[model samples]
Target: MPRVFLSFRKVDSRWMRDRVYQGLIGRFGAGEVFKSGESIPAGADFAEILRRQAAECELMLVLIGPAWLEARGDDGMRLIDRADDWVRVEIETALKAGNRVVPVLLGDATMLPEASALPHEIAHLARLQFLRVPETHLAEELERLCAAVADLMPDIGHGSASPTAPAAPAAEPTVTMTAQVSGGGSAYQAAGDQTIRLA
Candidate 1:
């Protein structure tokens, strides 16, 4: 399965983030998608975890909101100040690791400024490929995003056949067991005796 790193301004798009996370989980299964608040453990070293996730991810999806350009960190520092800031670090590491960096424009955000106009650490983001989400069809737009993610990881269950089939007298229940490790360090395994793991 290919890992994906999700980068966004938390305060600016919390609802959108949750929706995107749920959509990705529905398409790619839970383990392959990583978000800062949900994928990283509470007390873990954030910078290190972000770096590790970025290095392992096959793609990085940046959710750009209206305020994203002016977002600031908890310490009142601009997000572009340090390379270790979540968005900056993830994009930088993804680029260095040779992974695809996709900038998704959510809402009615304008084009990103030129690299020379951006802060040093995040200037490279200006050159990445960008996709814009339509204002009305949020779910449909998310589906498109999921499709893009699926394109990168064809085997990770984005379009895999469901284990269950319509009820038929001669058909047996084809149950599949999948294990998922949550960001909080919880292991979730399918609850069934005759479960076959998906390849």
Candidate 2:
């Protein structure tokens, strides 16, 4: 099972979700991160998969784009307010299971609504501090988010925390020398991992 669950509303933040998902996959490996539709099996039950992943994951990132709170269903009710909304179920399950649920504010998403504005099952989402992924500084902010997730779930392997290969040794510095020649000054340059003493 994946270590991290990405809870998102497709219409509201699919692009942002995909971007974050790729960054997380890069850090945590593709098998360690879960995004509902993309990670689920073709013939498997969607609701069961979502609930199981949400409940079992170590971290749940709720992608809150600008429209997340207010996006309405066909009946004009806020999607978050609906009991059957997948996003709602995902978050609620994670929260109920005592998993670490983080609200990630996607591009231009300012903040979460008040607790009272949300359904009781997921209302605590409003009280949680959020990580912002602004479009302007996605890479930098994404690194911060990835680091934070790794810190919170250090037992899980992360690229930054556990590199695939040991880092290469630093290159030796180049050395240049100028010596007086019979006709004119001469210059010489050498580069290698070596120590030289001029006599």
Question: In terms of TM-score, which candidate is strongest?
Answer: 2
lDDT of 2 by residue, 1-199 (tens): 7888888888886777788988988887887888877798899998788888999998899988888889997888888887888888988899999999999999864677789989999899999988888888788878988999888888676444445877899976766554444655464455564444543
Q: Tens-digit lDDT track for model 1 on 1-199?
A: 3377888877666677688889887776667778888777788998888888888887788888777777776888777666656677777778788887888887755566568867676677889878776567898998987877677667666334323345766756767666555567764465454574533
Question: Model 2: how far is 21 from its true place, Å?
Answer: 0.6
Those runs of model 1 whose alpha carbons end farther than 4 Å from true positions after fitting are 73-77, 158-199
TM-scores of all candidate predictions against the true structure: 0.71, 0.78
Give the poorly placed runs of model 2, Cα more than 4 Å off: 158-163, 166-199
Candidate 1 vs. truth: CA RMSD?
A: 16.8
Model 1: lDDT equals: 0.74
Give the alpha-carbon lDDT of every model: 0.74, 0.83
Query: Looking at candidate 2, what is the lDDT of residue 98?
Result: 98
